[model samples]
Target: MTLGREDQPGAQGSSIQDGERDSPSAAIPRLETGIPRLDYILKGGFLRNGTYAVMGPPGSGKTILGNQLCFERVRRSSSARCVYVTLLVESHAKMIRHLSGMKWFDTGMIPDRIYYISGYTALRDQGLSGLIDLLRRTLRERRGTEVLVIDGLESVEQRAPDVLAFREFVHEIQGLSALSDCTTFLLSSTGERSHSENTLVDGVIELTDQLIGLRAVRELTVHKFRGGDYLRGKHEVEIQSSGMVIHPRTEIQFDTPQASATEDRKRMSFGIASFDAMIEGGLLSGSATALLGAPGIGKTLLGLSFLVEGAKQGEEGIYFGFYEPPPRLCEKARKVGIDLDTYIQEGTIRLLWQPPLEHMLDSLAEQLLELLRHRPKPRRRLFIDGIEGFRAASVYLDRLPRFLSAFTNQLRMLDVTTLVSEELDLFTPLIKMPSPELGNVVENVVLLRYVELRSQIHRLISIMKMRESHYDRSIREFFIGEQGIEVADSFRSAEQILSGQARLLAGLQDREGES
Candidate 1:
């Protein structure tokens, strides 16, 4: 039932090549994959009648994604026929069943014009002559098709009489694509070697895994797209019972608005007044802040406070913890009166326990991608209990900086006002450790430490850094309470406390109970 609008070939090329681009109406419509964020990457969609390849390992969702693309075109053009040719897998029935379950698919819109062919193995076994003959017939039969999907091209390569023969066969398919002027997709599972099939294809979408939590987390990246610009990053995706879900990439844009330094009271309480005051207010509603200190210095406690306070304000929150056990962390929050249990039960908060640092395999990019995918609220806050916990837990420390940069960019874009806690080296006098990637990425930094004065240990709070405000530099004594962190009245100490040294004020009483 395609509307039968054949795109004038010379016209599409001339308009684009003639050095003067015409409006979209004069050009052939780009092929769209129904996935919203995905469509954005494909640059107005795939070029009409272009050859595209999806290369990945087995179970990377190449075939499933291909099927989804076909359905997307069929749904959009209505008249454009979709022809799917299968080789290594039997996906037709499963694809149809899966699409049928989606709310977008109507009972009567069974895509009457759609067609498919299976048993490509026999054709491959027939050798070069057999493949050419089958290709000829398929072309003749599906000439009117606007879109074509060839699944498991690797199967053809495996059965070809020889390596050279397989390579030649791949070349022929590329030629066929140009002559037909029909958008096409080839599915391939590539190995470590240079893939002859990939070289022959006009575009390639690669899927791979990042070892995380003792399991491989799936990711996708577009290596090349001849006629379009795509987001250049390995994005996290998942194959659930419903179908393939793609998590779009997030990169920080310099144009993104910065938080105002104004003295506005839009502060988001972290349920700790002292911590909030050091930050010039609590965390901003749409700003990112870091609680940077050494291990066991209460970084996670600060993260929990942000979550607890945000939840109290009726805003949702998510804790992506890379270290602590879920139950243990939740219990700790409960003891502090943060009441995370109710938040979980009420669906206002989500606690995603990441694999222990050692078993975590996914890149920071992938982890961030997953968090956004399952985020519970549209306008929620995010808390990463400790970044160093993730670093200490990772087996591959070399990639840490890269992961952090990519992750920070994503968090800022999501506008979730992240609370990224990190553990630093306790022996160092510095309030915060410098992250090569997170350079100036943090909006504010709150430092917590144990300062000793006259044989008594006191918890000190310092406003190490605030990007947009003139925060008080005075170090203050603080106490952790059942209701959360409380700032004790200002430090009226006899000595300077920040450098681990102090001098008694001449008039200040050092005697017992002298204020």
Candidate 2:
């Protein structure tokens, strides 16, 4: 949430203004935590001298985030100094030992750059007054103390005699931060902002680890970022060996995609001429297409053809899929004479294989977008095989509509022609659309089905819909000969083509009987 300059720190006339300098010529500076996407969520990191409360329950990664910030502060800047003061009696050695596994932890920065101390003794003996004096003296003793982390703010809160005293303690910490020109991070085990400590701080970053049904989801939210506007929502948060990795929600992140200036709305081919003829040459440039078919059908093969075609034309492409890795996927393409390995080796087409086990929807989208951003050229094609991979990875299945809509819209605006493959029932009498919103987001829908004709099974290809372009609707016999998928003549004599019960039309029957 964004706040006015008045409500935030580092402003000229802010309510909790930092230090004595109110010079008009000066600009409000920021202290980056050096964490990935944390600065992005903070809209250019936290205010330089701001006091932000990092609150969460136990085991919610609050401690890791706090320690990460500490190491990052010193790691990024040589002159940066940090002080980690924990009110809990847990030994700093144990904390250091626990953090040794993390990729960001630097052992050499101890004592000199980042000081680890205990506030438990001071808080227990002399109370809040004594703790405040200790911090004041520490900040003074360490001259370049730019970062201060109070690990057990909840302990300080519980020891306060009343709410007013707790608020006063927070206010005093804020004052000390401003006087010392330090960005303070108060890590507490209080997830809710019901206490006075939340509102008294410059910002509140909350991390929650909760079970949604059977799956445990960890989310991070910037409840209050006083200085500037941030992407407001529950973002995906993960704790790995490196540190915290955050993925801002797709819909919220690309709410307004930057419109590309390229007006080159040309057809993007799938390398198959006859199939291209059926869909009005090919899919319109910068348009999304839904390649819907049953399992074992040519859905995956068709997507590969599209990407391979782009790679042949010197246009960059990305194959973002879940099930098949690069090796297996290239082998599958080789069966159809689609030489994907050559283009892949030449750095024209990239095969991004993501395993379909326990993944985040936004993370996949961001990963694809990151790959796409590097290639600043037009005619960029993306083939997302097994679109259900996204559905499977999402916490809420209902969010697929909004997410796909935003995802495809952003790709289109970037002048990328996108194709997504979704599976249909193998042998059903009626075609069940995979999703209600899948067709709505795409500009074209290609239906591939198996038709039982004359006591034999045959594959038929047809274009169900193509927006803003005239497409051939005749159902053609789809065959996979030695050269790959070839679109044959339409089944003009057969009626009820898609129902798997095709019969000769009355006129064609009569003509056959007469002949």
Candidate 3:
């Protein structure tokens, strides 16, 4: 969701005058972390001079995030400096070596714009007070330091003589942060938290990596942002060589502008003239359509035809397929007499491929949104070849409905006419929906199935639902050949086409017997 600067008050870090306390001009001064998505989640960026806590279990990416912020700060501002103090016994050299692999790491900033110091020995030998003294001295000497990151808060907690001492240490750092106008990040690998520690920090961010049925998913949550209305939820985070990439969940404002009358009146062809006729002259321009079918029922071919038609009509589209790579998809399309490779080469179609396993739903949404942002008005059509891919990617199956709803809403906001293919279980006699949630979010449903008749299996297509429009209800026979999909004539003599076992109608049988 896009929140204008006015929707949120300036961060608490900004000093307020008595007369201008409620003035709109008193916006919070922000310190950009250089992580675009994270900044967006924070309602711009972190509050300048704020003391925030980054809490997580070991290897949950606290260190990587802190280092990334530091490197980005120094890279952006030549005068900006950061002090990275570690209370763990890990040597500075080892830490630097680990960071050197990250894209944000800058060796030239070391000992100058970014200072790495170890407080492990002092904290171990002299306790919390010694660590506090070290920080005080560093802040005093480095007056220009704009940021301070303590990489090991747990070390001080372990060495503290008592809870009071640990609380005192946290308080001292918070005071120092306020006095020096330096944004501070305290990284702790502790699962346990103290009330005083939470109370003293201006904000708290929690990172987690947990196994969800053999796959580990990493997430970040904003536990508290004292003076900011940060996006609230568990945001997906991926740690790559470039550093942390946070994808806030898709949140579409309810007040988003409705589609223009012209946009609503427009209809998009599925590249098949007969199919368009069934759907009352094609799908509504910005609507989401679901193509449901069993395996080998030509769902993929239909989706490909739709995309190819859009491309042929001079419309840009995205093919987000989970099963096949681009080259394989192109080869398959060519066999049907459609050259997907040509459209791909001409930049009319952007193909995105994702493997079936260990995929994040939010990541896919973010990728689609990014593509739309770059392509803008001309990019109108989107074909997601596998709906089951999202279902498999979801850790919580129950949230699938909500996620799909929000995702489709976002697509609608971008004015994309989306078609999604869902694979139903094969050999089932009944026509089962791939997802019950589809009934709510999808504006139209197209059903494809194999119907057994007279010892032969024939493919049939029907329009199940068309919201706000008239559509042909007849179940038509279709075939896939070198010329692609062809729909012709309804099964006039058949009954129960949806049951996967079509039987001749009694009237047709009687007439045939008389003949």
1 against 3, candidate with superior TM-score: 3
- Residue 132, candidate 1: how far off, in angstroms? 2.9
Q: Could you give candidate 2's per-residue lDDT for residues 1-515 as a string of tens digits? A: 00011111111121111222233312568776656677666656788899999989887898888777777777667678888899987888888888777776767777788888899999999999999999999999998898899998989988999999999999999999889999999999886876678877888989999999778899999888775667687888888876777777888766766655268689898878888888767888899988889887788888888988888889898888899888899888898888889999998998888876889888888777766765578889899998889988889887889999888888887789988889998888888787868999998988988766566667778899899899898987777655667877556766777776777676563123210
| Local lDDT at 487 for model 2 | 76
- Top candidate on lDDT is 2
Error of 2 at 351 (Å): 1.0
User: What ranking emerges by TM-score with the best candidate at the front?
Assistant: 2, 3, 1
**Deviation (Å) of 9 in candidate 3:** 30
Q: Mind giving the per-residue lDDT tens digits that candidate 1 earns over 303-360?
A: 8778877888888888888778889988887776778898889977888877663333
In candidate 3, position 211 carries an lDDT of: 86
**lDDT, ranked from best to worst:** 2, 3, 1
- Score residue 479 of candidate 2 by CA lDDT: 71
C-alpha RMSD for every candidate? 8.2, 7.1, 6.6
lDDT of each: 0.63, 0.79, 0.78
Candidate 2: segments with Cα more than 4 A from true spot? 1-27, 259-261, 506-515
Instruction: Give Cα distance to truth, residue 260, candidate 3, Å.
Output: 7.2
For model 3, what is the alpha-carbon lDDT of residue 191?
60
Encode model 3's per-residue lDDT on 389-419: one tens digit a residue.
8888777788788888877876787789999
